[model samples]
Target: MLLMNEKIKASEVALTGLRGEDLGIVGREEALAMAREAKVDLVCTSLLSSPPPCKLVARGAAKQTDAQEKKAERIQGGAVKTKELRLTAHIEEHDYETKLRQAEKLLTSGHAVQLTVKLAGAKEGERAKALIDRMLKELAPHGTRETGIQVSGKQAAVKVNPA
Candidate 1:
């Protein structure tokens, strides 16, 4: 929460001008007087600081600035996009080619690709591994494998990233 003007309880504060110029330290009363003189609000920026930092901001500009900062943080903290492509050990040649083209397209467009192969019988694990290896080899020009093939019970998977 932000404390403005008379609501600020600190006796003294490190002040900044409306244009963000440092104004050093001043008594809360003096800061409020300055704010009043400049037709702006004295808003406490950081309450945890030694003397609490306050700035002179236009009436609604403080809230607007805070909202913009939050929006920027949300955009910067967004996660990378990832695409998943599932395959079968007994896939036909044409279907395999189609999947390879899709993976290539996804990788070239900057999306991380998770390649997964489903296994049926115990002996099918080798075929699944072979299939995954073949796909990785085909995709080598477009992407690099981020994780080595992982086989768990009836599935094998790998992560690939754009080169």
Candidate 2:
């Protein structure tokens, strides 16, 4: 959680200016006054540090920066990539083979695969599930089924992870 502007209650804070310059430790009131003068917000960044580190940020930029940092972390943190493949219940054999190859390639490259089979009618649900089961069987060597067939109103889905 972030405490901004007047919501910050620490008596003193280690401040950093808006331009990323260190402003050193200062009184909380002084930091708030500087933020007010600069027409920005006083945000407490690290409440656990000595004097509680604070920084000057434009209104709403704190959350934006946090989101950007999280996105960067996710990209750099070896997050697993999930690829979705959509199919129809009555797919052609050639198309099925193509999709199977694509899935196998994805699994070989350490990506998770979500297989979705769309049903044209209520009666097609069983066929879609059977198709997924057959695909899972064929993909057993390349990947392991992470989830059983999940049938919603008009779609059946399954998840597979690399072996």
Candidate 3:
């Protein structure tokens, strides 16, 4: 989840989204108090900001408006945007099937899935490669990779699109 804070305080100087660096330690009420003390409304700058939280301030009549904005955002992003599913090198059949089912659900809705694999050592690397290979095969039968598998240290990611 991400919090957005847009300072729309024209009547007064608002400091919106002041909880980016200090996220997780503050709540809406706390944020509101922080904004109110600062004389502004808490507006979300980037609700889905990779870090998962952001806030700002503006002096306006947007009290608890963050609720509405967040709700709307949740509905939109939650239902529409891409979703990811994770699998380890030694993932079992039932677990793989489950995650695949979930990924298929998202893909059927025109959403992308980022298949991520985590590895440990050389032995784990071989297992990771094997798991990734099998996943690619399964996905190939039903989907295609828009982005090829990429490795970032011990993790590999590929963007899959439904066929």
Candidate 4:
């Protein structure tokens, strides 16, 4: 529900005294004016609130200061959870590499990834196992296979960790 570059609801912005506060009931022009004065982005903090609004503060500075704390919380809480990569039956080498890069990004973000290799129709035999083995080897340097690769109903799932 929290979208980047989108306005947040009024009820969600926290009051930070004079430094920063929620722009409850403030229009776009007023927000821009406040930002012009404070020299910060009018970012919306809480989205799930009535009459979606924004918070007036410098997002770059705030994020830089709190990045570590936020990362720590994500590492502890599994809420920022696993990301998945879906592989098709006829994936090309370049496509595979692209998917791998995306998987790496997910892993770097401290997210567990489920690489799903799906097979259908004619391409459902020896080729599938070979592809799965290759993918598993690629994943070996990153995470140990806590639960070995599972293949069921023409799909194999590889769970990997952050390298």
Candidate 2: the clashing residue pairs are: none
Ranking the candidates on lDDT from highest down gives 2, 1, 4, 3
Worst 10 residues of 1 by lDDT: 71-80
Decide which is better by lDDT, 2 or 4: 2
Which residue runs of candidate 3 sit more than 4 Å off their true CA positions? 1-80
The C-alpha stretches of model 4 lying farther than 4 A from their native spots are: 1-74, 122-125
Residue range 12-122, candidate 1, lDDT tens digits: 999999888999999999999999998999999887887999999998898888877764564466664789999988999999999999999998766789999988877
- Model 1 alpha-carbon drift over 4 Å, by segment: 1-78
Q: How far off is residue 85 in model 1, in Å?
A: 0.5
TM-score between model 3 and native: 0.46
lDDT of 3: 0.62
Best candidate according to lDDT: 2
Top TM-score model: 2
Better of 1 and 4 by TM-score: 1
For 91-162, candidate 3 gives per-residue lDDT tens digits of 889998988788777766557788888876546766676676777787665567888667667777787865
In candidate 3, what residue range of length 10 has the lowest lDDT sum? 7-16
Superposed Cα deviation of residue 9, candidate 3 (Å): 53
**What is candidate 1's CA lDDT for residue 101?**
95
Q: Tens digits of per-residue lDDT for model 2 on 96-125?
A: 999999999998777889999998899999
Q: Can you give the TM-score per candidate against the true fold? A: 0.52, 0.53, 0.46, 0.48
